[model samples]
Every structure is written in structure tokens, then in C-alpha cells.
Target: MNLRFGLPQPLLSFTLLLVWLMLAGASAGNVVLGLVLAWLLPLFTQGFWPDNPAIHKPWKLVWYVLKVIVDIVVASITVARLVLSFRREPNSAFICYPLTLEHPLGITMLASTISLTPGTVSADISDDYKMLLIHALDVTDDEALMADIHKRYEKPLLELFS
Candidate 1:
């Protein structure tokens, strides 16, 4: 168990195991097959894992994912309501949100999270990656939207990846 792997091997193993379980569904036979696949796949691909930011907190990771799920549901409803309102709302506009999280992985996760939620899409990342341009279905309050993103996704992501 050399530290050269950067992260503990068990953590990587557990992640692969969970991914297998999700991909195979929840049946007992699938679970057993997933476990076997999880164990064997990593052994053949050891070099693909990168040694980067160490996630020191597991609870924060769980919280971040849970928050994203809730946000996605809320955004879906908002988008549905706007769509059903019959031309009451204007087409969305692009908004520039200043970002403080500099990590590449963190920025990527943020972008993907924004895109996954309905009513919003990640349009561009600035050349310096210091700003994110997001298009919202209804651009009522730019400041409020930025604040919401910061409080909801960015803050937790900063904790998790930065």
C-alpha cells in the first residue's frame, strides 16, 4: 500500500464498486457481478487514476450531491411552470457569474451541475476560467441568480474540491 497512488486504494475500490452497482441495477446477482467487476477492472487500469486534490471530507461530498439533486428537481418545476405559462416569460438571457473556485475539476463539476438542471445551461467559461456564463430560462434578477448559485452549488463544491 504505497502512498504513490495518492488516494487510498480502498477509496478508489469503493467508488468503482458503487459505480458498478449503479450500472448493473439492484439485483443480488448483479450486485455480486458488480463487485467482481469492480475488483478486477481497477487492477488492469491502475495508471489511469490521477493524483490530484485529495478529498478530505466525505460528508461534504454527500451533501454536495444531495443539494444538486434537490436543485435539479426545483429547477425542473420552475422550467415546467415557465413553459406552461404561455408567453408570459421572456426568453432566457446569458448571465456572467464571477467565480472564485479555480480548480479545473471544480469548475467542470459546476458546469455539469448547471447543465443538468432544467431552465439553465452553461454557455461558456471565460478564457481565464474565472467567470461562467450561464443562460437562464427567466432572467429576472441577475444578482439573485448568482447568489443562489454561489450559496447552493459553488460553496459546497469549493469545500469538496478546492
Candidate 2:
């Protein structure tokens, strides 16, 4: 049976359900309420969603998430040390990274990931969306920073979205 009522993206529904349950706890009443919200939320908001892309590699996504977590920890330490040192004015920079991933969601994810790391912020995307502008708090080497973003974040997102 087609239960979507036009809500074709079931994963989002499941995630909403799980998030609700986690917040409310997994009591029987919570589970039932969570299920109800999960089912109805998607139906209610289907029009707001664009075409949902299928995730081609779930395993790769898990690995990518782990790598991001590791990077975040490392970057946090690096930023903290830089801040405490107060030994030098940070070599801050705004980097224009040329984009390869054309998907809107992918681009958004890439921007979000960059901003998630310590000492960096995604300032803007180009009007054409062909490039992303990022501000690094302490960039001793622009090329290295660009390479890191290209390899660590952009590549995996391209693989996932494409």
C-alpha cells in the first residue's frame, strides 16, 4: 500500500520519529506518539521538500562521519591552542573554493561541514554556486586548507550526491 500520501522520503520520516523518541524516551506512549508524528510530519511538509536524492553508499557515509568527528576533535584542539597561545595574530583568510558538486543539498552539506569545524566559517557561496567562500581563523597555508576541504569534505559529498 502507498502510505506516503505523497511523502516519498521515508528516511526523513524515520529520522524525525527517532529524534522524537530519543527526546521523549521510548515508553509505549512515546513510541505511539512518535510514530504518529513521524507519519504526519512528512505528509504535512511534503511540499516544502525538493527531489530527494538517494544515498548511494551508506557505508561510505558512516566512514565519512567518523572522519569528520576525528577532524573536529583535532581542529578543536588546534584552535584552542592557537587562541591560548596569543602569540601571533592569526593568519586568517577567506578562501574561494571552486565547487564540483552541483547538487543543492550537497553544497549545503559541504558548507555546513566546514562551518562545523572549529576556527572556520562558511561565509558565502558564489552567486552561480560554483564556488564557496570560507573564512579560516588561522590559515598558515591557503593551498593546504583548500586541499583539506577538497579532499576531506567535498569529495565524499560528491560521491554521496552523484
- Count clashes in each candidate, considering only residues at least 3 apart in sequence or on different chains: 0, 0
Worst 10 residues of 2 by lDDT: 1-10
Candidate closest to the true structure, highest TM-score: 2
C-alpha RMSD by candidate, in order: 4.8, 3.1
For model 2, residues 1-108, the per-residue Cα lDDT tens digits are 235655456888899989999899999999999988888888887778877677788788888889889989999999999999967888899999999999998899
Candidate 1 lDDT tens digits, 1-162 = 344344335566678878877876889998888767666676666677555666667699888888889988988888888888896966678999999888888899899999999988999999999999999988888999999999999988888875
Can you list the residue pairs that collide in candidate 1?
none
Model 1 residue runs over 4 Å out of place are: 1-50
How much lDDT does candidate 2 score? 0.88
* Structural similarity to truth (TM-score) of each candidate: 0.70, 0.81
